[model samples]
Target: MAATFNGRLFLKNTAYLTSTGFKVILAYSRTTNFFYAYYVLRTLTAMICEGSINCLALAYVADNVLERQRTSAFGILSGIATAAFVCGTLAARFLSTALTFQVAALVSMLAAVYMRIFLEESLPNGENLTQPILKSGQDDHCQDGDLSRKAPVLKKIPSIQDIIGLLKSRVTFSQAAVVAFFNSLAEGGMQASIMYYLKARFHFSKNHYADLMLLLGIAGMASQLVFMPLLAPHVAEEKLLAIGLLGGIADALLYSVAWSNWVPYATTIFAVFIVCVPPCLRSIASKQVGPTEQGKAQGCISGIISFANIISPLIFSPLTALFLSEDAPFHFPGFSILCIGFVTMIAFFQSVLMRGPPPVSSHKISCNSLVA
Candidate 1:
């Protein structure tokens, strides 16, 4: 349904990013002082674009998934994404040296064609474009998360301003942006640096680490399917987020303590935490925005995440190199992770304490305010 659309869109875009990044790097035959930086920026730019597009996919689904089933729906969506990730990793391991970027691009293009031809639109005519659909409790044809059918068919594309206006909606957009920023900051550091740490510490080969990641992905998928659906319905979103923060902090600390190969076993539990949090973040945001706004909401929130991913590595790469040197200050990154845990705990408390926004002045605040 909607989850399928979102998952497919995200995966296809990721594949596109992979191929495009390689193409760019290959075209630049002459390596310069800025070559590595240029490569990093280009690769990240493609990833950010993919992340932004995912928001639109998320928005398509939020309106359709019932409160009771949303958690399970998200789980299924995540499962598809992880499975695709494993496949892509395996494909890259085997075919990267043999196949050119053009071949990868061709495969993606064919997949896109199949989706365009066979996949049904979830939303048609944008008939449900208006707000208040959530309030009305309509079960309209919400599968596939395509509300495009509900919208008018314009002969011309929208202007940049029109798109910006969609992103500028204050209520859900602002909060989504903030949450995305935090989530990405945490993930970029956790994922990128951990692999480096494992390789440096345990004399592990890149291939071995990839295998480890594959196993972690499988475990993560299982944990999400078992836990998220069952807990998301009963637990308050803020509390769920708080608990996840604690889990992530514990995961980071646990990694710092990984003295031997046995340490990765503990690391797997932390991987489960990483896999489970994003959906919770999405579900909370989905509940706030209506169906029509889902695209903009997902885009903006994801944009924030993209922004974080873009910046954090730039800031931390040097720190990791400088402080977490081969000999000295090995514990700085671990301490930094501990600080993230503390900051997140405080933020979660504030979120819970606030629960909802302040009461509006009837004459002052416009009724259009969605978050309020």
Candidate 2:
């Protein structure tokens, strides 16, 4: 929908979620019975309002930023996200549960309000550069040049055909998609099983989790904001991607063999580089399509990550559980994490084989601008 219409236009509506979030928070404070229901409602609301918000944001960057500067632009965006994560984690440590919720809700609302006021449209004058031409009699719902009867709502949304078309368009795009899938698979697996493994092995509590996350966030923020912007100018995105994947492999493998509690914490030094992988992938992908196709391209990649997020736990969670159980054939508590390292290794190998995407010409950049 953002590819066909406009992404920036929809971002302001995410503020609506802040109101619903507060309702859930209030429900939590008052009654336990309705809290889950409210939280579920909020989740559903997120699906409606902000399901593709991150993709849309990436698409906007692809549209406005020049190709030469895109990797750094993406790195900066990621850095901001990491910085926010660090602040949020630190804030949660000191605040009461309710106060944390209140602060979070207000911050979300304020961010959305700011976007509404100041955000510029990447797709100029509501002209969607990427909209497909409709064949005559292709759809009864589409009326040419009729503002009142443009098309059905479903036609605005991307379909399986859209992703397939994108994948077939560029071989680099396809390769990047494969790399993204395995990387996200490892990430989703980590989310499902890593903390439990730490808890079982080291008797780690919530504070320990907070501390580990803080260390990762701080280091990752510096790498994205500081290291990537500097390195992206000097090296190719494919190389950066390969380096980041190596970091992922190192982080996972180090954790798998953690001899003591300090070893897991020490692994943060390697984990910091893992955060750079997505930005490098996104930078490469943005070059595969024309200016008009940013939303479709980014959306397709985001869909791959979403699909991986859905299925990874199904594959790894049980594996982790089985390995941790006393009745298992293997004695390694870190076996599942080692499996995640192997998954990262797969992505790293793919990245090593990948080459740099062809650079966009300065002439094309100016002429093919999303602006009319």
**Highest TM-score: which candidate?**
2
Residues 56-85 of candidate 1 have per-residue lDDT tens digits of: 446545556664455567666776778767
The C-alpha stretches of model 1 lying farther than 4 A from their native spots are 1-48, 93-96, 99-107, 124-176, 326-333, 336-372
Give Cα distance to truth, residue 296, candidate 2, Å: 1.2
List, residue by residue over 215-297, the lDDT tens digit for candidate 2. Answer: 99999999999998999899888988998999999989888988899997898887567878989999888777655567778
Predicted candidate 1, C-alpha RMSD: 8.1
Among these predictions, the greatest lDDT belongs to: 2
| Each candidate structure's count of clashing pairs | 17, 0
The TM-score values for the models, in the order shown, are: 0.69, 0.85
Model 2: per-residue Cα lDDT at residue 84: 95
